[model samples]
Target: MKTKRIILSALRSLGKNKLRSFLMMIGIIIGIIALTLIVSVGFGAKKQVMERVNKFGAESIMIRAGGGVQISQMSANQGTTTLKLADAEFLENIIPEIKGVAPFSSKGNTDIKYFEKSATVGLLGCTPSYAPVWDWNVTAGEFITDEDMKLLNRVCLIGTTVQKELFGDSYPIGEQIRIDNIQFEVKGILEPKGTSPGGGDMDNRVMIPLSTFMRRVANIDYLSAVKVLLHNPKEINTTAEKINQILRERHSLAEGEPDDFTLITPTEATEMAEKVSGTFNLFLALLAGLSLITGGFVIANIMTISVNERKKEIGLRKAVGASSKKIVLQFLFEALAITISGGVIGIVLGGAGAVILGIVMQIPVSVSWASILTGVISASIIGIVAGIQPAKKAARLNPIEALK
Candidate 1:
């Protein structure tokens, strides 16, 4: 009954000064909207990044040679040569837990041409095992087979972007293309993979058999890295340890010698990305939260002025048997009602803005239940906290003096 009367009084007061009430909640509206948009964008980015990583087989680990170690053999008289095909084969034999191993080498800049179109693409050299390790989907034709690798076939599978650049509407399969002046047939086209958030152009690569790459392009029997597929992501640490032991022994490294290779898991990459995203979101949230705090102060100030203006009414009510508690409740309810209404409007407007931005920007937008609830609850709390002191002051006023 008291709650109903207080709410009714709050409604009447707000109705009497609609402009003033709206002005008081401006800060809160801005705060909620900004916070909602920031959170939605942050979570959307995280989800997209994880999806990309998952496509690469999250359980897989990449083992790459340390800096400046390109080849497998180094002589005292000659220069450095870091990774060899034999090393990869040896690791496979020694590490029983590894499901598969695909040693890869790459040429960063390769002029590729098909018909009248041309593009400079990253030429990846790997065995057929790479198809499984990388979880690549060949949309048309077929992936490189073990037999093709054994025979060192001069054939290539192009990324979707590469196909678009080189073939246009023409069927790429069996079409002849030139890579570094060497002729090769188009064996496959990879499924379209959207641009990575980290700016990796996954759709602009070309893959070829490792043997063909060594003989024709790089003219070297070495690899830059070895991708290993594990039976499960849970065995990441164990598999990493085993690979390290095998590589150390194979490289004939003595105790205390620095490792010449590094192993990285998808989880590590995901965690790093998440940390970056969290920091960015936190900075934005803080800025938005500051606006909310400022809005609370506005509400407090307005309520204070309201109490002064209504002093005569308050005095009359008190003289007519209104308790101090009832007066306090009335003012607090008014503040809360204004803030809660503002919160609702802010959420709806923010969501609409996010949807429009997502369409325009070509990015995902998400609104979680927790975020909506948090906004509503936080706004109400802000109103209550801001109004408390002023409400108490009004409640404690001397009715006789206030009537003056």
Candidate 2:
């Protein structure tokens, strides 16, 4: 009952000086907001990174040709022996762990024209299964079918940027676009994928059937890369080993000779993204921590001044038979109450700030309970510790001298 009375008295004293209490809470409020916003940004970045990694599909692998010795090394060899479409076909025929393979070649930064409207874009030649293998969604018309591949049809699917440049929001289906003087009909428009987290522009590419590209465009029997889709992602290492063995045998390469191709997994891409995000999160957390430390110092300063101001009151209570321990409890409880209130307000503001940033900045923001609890508990501890020095000073004051 006595402790309860002291707490109530402390709260009443704080209420009497409302503006001062509000001023004291300002530091804490700012600290909470900063911490919350930074942590939420970290989580948002992680989400974006993970989403990009998954865009390549969990079961996907890419095989690309590695550059060989220079032309000067051998007069007859210009370093052109590389992974071919036939190699991909052979793997498809033999490898049981491989679900499917799509051979693709691409060239970028070329001007394409459609009825006088022209734009510089990337052009890629790929098999029919490439679309589903990469998880690309078609917004209109249809993707290249087996019939298109068999006939070597000059049909293409355009990215969002190309569609806007050539067709300008109107339906681009049935339109024809000329790439490097070769005409192709627009069969579909890929759903807007925007820019990737790596800053690559996926929305500016034009995709065409591999057969058309081989016949009319590059005229090369070799392929730039092969996308290998696995049946199971967890068995990637084993699958890669088997693929290397097959490729070495097929190429007739001797021992200690490096394979002419590179095999990359989606898991490696995801790990790269995670490492980048982790560093960003650490930087943000450190920046926010500094602000929180400054806030804690401000809280300590205010509590100290508060102890000085309430010295006469403390003396009066002690003269009226209040114990030193009771005096300490009262001041400590008052500081705690003020801090708890500030902490609550800070959390609400911080969460609101995160949501507002997500909407306005066009970035995703997420707040977990762990972050909230950390902020609240840290602020409360700051208040309790900051108030101690002042509380002890107030408790040890000479009552007679305090009254004078």
Our tally of clashes for model 1 stands at 5
User: Which is the leading candidate under TM-score?
Assistant: 1
Backbone clashes in model 2, listed as residue pairs = none
| lDDT on C-alpha atoms for all candidate structures | 0.82, 0.79
Which segments of model 2 are wrong by more than 4 Å? 1-8, 15-26, 65-81, 137-139, 192-197, 244-262, 319-326, 337-363, 367-371, 396-404
205-289 per-residue lDDT for model 2 (tens digits): 8989988887788787777777788898987888888888988888788999987876666666667666777787778777766
Worst 10 residues of 1 by lDDT: 70-79
Q: Would you estimate the TM-scores of all the predictions? A: 0.89, 0.81
Q: Pairing residues by index, what is the TM-score of model 1? A: 0.89
Q: Kindly report which residue stretches of model 1 are placed more than 4 angstroms away from their true locations once superposed.
A: 67-81, 196-198, 252-257, 353-365
